[model samples]
Target: MSEAFGSVLWLIVAIGILVTFHEFGHFWVARRCGVKVLRFSVGFGKPLWSRKDRHGTEFAIAAIPLGGYVKMLDEAEYEVPAAQLGQAFNRKPIWQRIAIVAAGPIANLILCVALLWVMFLIGKPDYSATLGPTQGLAAQAGLRDGDRLERIDGRSTETAMDALQVLMLAAIDHRDVAIQASDANGHEVQRKLALSRLPADFDQQNLEKAIGLVWHFQVAPATVGTVTPDSASAGLLQSGDQITAIDGQAVRYWNDIAPLVKQWGERGGEAMVEVDRQGERLALLMQPRQQLNPDTKQQAWVLGITPAPRKAPEHDALRRYGPLEAIPAAFRQTGRMASDSLAMMRRMLTGEASAKSISGAITIAQVANATAQQGPATFIFFLALLSLSLAILNLLPIPVLDGGHLLYYLIELVKGSPLSERSMVAGQYIGLALLAGLMGLAFYNDILRLVT
Candidate 1:
């Protein structure tokens, strides 16, 4: 219950911050354009908290936390006094109105860049594109374990994250992706991955599994670090004990031990463990326990022994940058994300990608909560990504959105007059219907995810 509440709280905070900045853009632009601001609100419905400024603008926190708006004095909405007619939004020039309408999404994009800039300044964990295992397309392409990814197609990939981003788009389009990688001996080689074999119901989350590219990180030794209380290995295992074999099979890396123990546990069998304690060899019988995997939340075998920490190689670092470099990098990051989002959207529209990839409030809340728990830097990164997503989503040419309004304004600019009220009202109805269907699809995807 507490966890659920915490997720809700995080979601509310994230929405509130994003909405505030978004609405502020419209409010600020309108005021600068000589329009009379009526109410500046974060969220919709009844005002939860409100204050009227000396300028007669009402600032409000409303009941619904999903979205917000900056209401300005407009002749179309209400009767304007002759004296204040010049200050009405409807009286503003077409350019001024366009600027006001575009400001909200622009602010979100700016916020995304700002957040990324801060993130780079503070530094975040980084890793190379080291391969652990290759199967499917990757294996067919002759990608080997320990190979370091250099580039995808012509784009240089500095890290695994970069490669993954490229691969995701390539998979969606069923494009043949070219890659340059460094072998174990540091020899650069090129390979082409054909993604045509990927199933139509491709799961984005399991891209690595589908493409057969496992992320390789620093591997721990077989030495135990700490034992969990009342766990399967608590009594039988001790800190600093070096596990040699599992069920008479010799194990080298820590990853080698897990599957063996898990297989034994699933069949309710014991692990015939052999460990070297100090200089003495000892035979110990350990039984694995059924525990919920923290990530998958599925029943899995666990010995409850934390692996000893391994020092990260110098190559693996938190990529840090100064203000000057960070700003440019942030812009590039924002652009890259925006481009990727548009590509994914296009793929979905063309039926090359599943609509299930669309995430709703439930998924957003869960991600926000999970990222918040990871650390402040991670949470901030998540927020930046979300800000970009919000900006792009709002810019879609749909009715009842800023983009829709901008579209109408563009038409008015070209036609030398505003759209007729009857046409505008009909457009609004159509937009509402499209939006409702989209929302329903998103909700259905979210619920299906939970069930499956």
Candidate 2:
């Protein structure tokens, strides 16, 4: 299937599953509380398909699949029969009402753990937490080649991803952190990473570059994959050509090309570009093409050649757990993700983190498609993250959300009554306005990412 179609389809499937679990939480709880559910729907708006359950609740699939709700019998919303007065939600005790409203987010949180458990049951392959020769911040921090990272800020880092994640988060917050590593002699070493030394204009797209940490096995050979049509290297460079030098500068790895390209592209001169093509060395003098770089949005010179796709090397790390062991692992993983997510949100509110991190449907769809393509384990991990996000977002103290309703109930419990209709209505408008602004910002960030 086309990528776009696949993205949209997977997004729908994911949202459907998450929403069903959320709404079912309320449905199950409400039923157990003896409250009559008028309808249980997995989506909003007009019902596409529906059936009446034995308990008289109409279960439905709606046309708009973005959100769903459980309609409970309430005296405030509809006239109730005298015989069914006890079944009206408004007549229930304040504690039961609170439980009913809180159930959705709680359900999402539970789903996150369950999904993570399944993911752990299926192993995840990862790169070793080994680095090449360090430079800049890393070198200054006393890290070096052959050192394997063991922990960052006391959290174990078994894979490259684990180390990168911790480092990136610390970099973004401009926080110095302690790292523990093992040297070639198997001796433990401790170092403090001065992330504060990071340049204000560092490459945001490549957080690792600013930290000067390179994966040991990720350095690909300088083999040409494809040359962009009509560019400087179009006719001169061929596939499988190994670039040996650019403008008389030695090029040993794919990562070595960009700096040289920029250096020559800025000097405004035709330079000798040497390549080994089928064991014959060929040299071509060509002026590096100059154009605006989309990512950095600055004028940059380029050869317009892409590196060949590398084959998957042997995995140096794996995260797998037995069925029983996965339970606690899932819980721990979920807690960490939840904590990090909350911390990031807090930082964003205080302007300590970039608001550019916000993303919309486009980003979500793309990520869903990518993870699904990778494998079931990765897809399950994505779902767990997404599910946790759903839970936390719903728990926000905004009117019309689960947390907002819980807040109202709590207030009622304290004041011995519900708020006035006018107050509740105003709160809803304010909540909608806040949610709308966040959505707009997320969309803007997503579009910005696509273009740049």
Candidate 3:
């Protein structure tokens, strides 16, 4: 399938699962509380498909397929018969009302944990968090070459992604943190990362650039591992030869070789290639064969030599556990993610982090497609993360959300009565405005990311 189609398809599936579970929580709890539920709908607007259960509760799959809701029999929304007044949602005890309202987010949290368990049972592949070349704050804090990252602020980081995530948050909050790593000799070293020095305009999206932490593989040596037969370098440049310079220009890394060779081929002349063959320096003059590059669809130079592959670093980890062990692991993982997410929210509120950090449906769909392509484990992790985020957002004390209702109920409990209709309506409008602003910001960030 095309990328756009794949993204849309996955987005629909993900929302379907999360929304269904959330609605189910409310449906199940309301029934248990002896309150009558009118409809259970996944998505909104016109119903595409619907079925009525024995209790006359209409369950529906609607046209929109974005969100779902459970409609409870409430005296506030509709008139109730005298005989069925006990079944009205508003007539229920304050605690039962609170339980029913709180169930949706709780269900999402449960789903998040369950997804994480499945993800852990199937390991995710990721690059090791090996510390590469360091500059600025990283170098000043004593981070050195060939060091494999072990932990940040006592939180263990097993992948490059893990280390980068912790560093990004720390940089956002300008929190100086202690880190642990193993040197090239397999000896442990600890240092304080001076993230407090990060400039106010630091970009969370490009933390590596601001922090000066690069992967070792990104700076591979310019050593030739293979030379194609009858190619320009076939007879002259043997395997294991390090291309130090080309046409009197320095070839600092493997990436430098290609462009330099292209320049010489375009100039249509023999170029002097310097090599360090097992530490013995030698120079050879050879002309590059010019050919149309199929991938780029342009005429380009060809030396027909591939760079030597770099070995995997020491801290490589597979995030898998046995089925029995995965239970606790899943809970631990969820707690860590939730903590990190809340910290990010706090920083954003305090203006320590940019609001552009938020993402809307567009970004979610794109990321969903990418993670699905990566593998099942990664996709599962993404789903769990999305579910947890949804749960937390719904719990916020704003009107027109699960959290907002809970807040109103709490006030009702304290005052021994519901708020005035005028006050409740006013709260709803305020809640809607806040939600609109947040969604606008999220969409703006997603579009900005697409444009730039």
Global lDDT of each model? 0.87, 0.89, 0.90
Clashes of each: 0, 0, 0
> Which of candidates 1 and 2 is the stronger one according to lDDT?
2
Best by TM-score: 3
Tell me the lDDT of model 3 at 335: 96
Query: Model 2: per-residue lDDT, tens digit, 12-123?
Result: 9899999999999999999989999999998889999999978899999999988798999998897999999999999999999999989999999999999999998998
Please give the range of 10 consecutive residues that has the lowest summed lDDT in model 2. 199-208
Better of 1 and 3 by TM-score: 3
Give the lDDT ranking, best first. Answer: 3, 2, 1
Can you write out model 1's per-residue Cα lDDT over 1-452, one digit (the tens) per residue? 47788789899999999999999999999999999999999989999999999999999999998888898999889899999999999999999999999999999999999999999998876778888756788999999878989999888788888898899988877788889999989999999998878887778768888888876774556889899999988788899999998888886667777898877777786658899999888888888888888899898888898888776544464757999999899999888889889988998888877787888988889899988876777788899999999898889888799999999999998899999999899989999999999999989988988899
Tens digits of lDDT, candidate 3, 1-452: 99999999999988999999999999999999999899999999999999999998999999998998999888889799999999999999999999999999999999999999999889877778876667778888888877888999998998887787798888987889999999989999999989999998987778888888777755788889999899898889999999999999987678678888878887898879999998899999899997788999988798988887765433356788999999999999899899989988898888887788899999999999998987899899999999999999999999999999999999998999999999999999999999999999999999999999
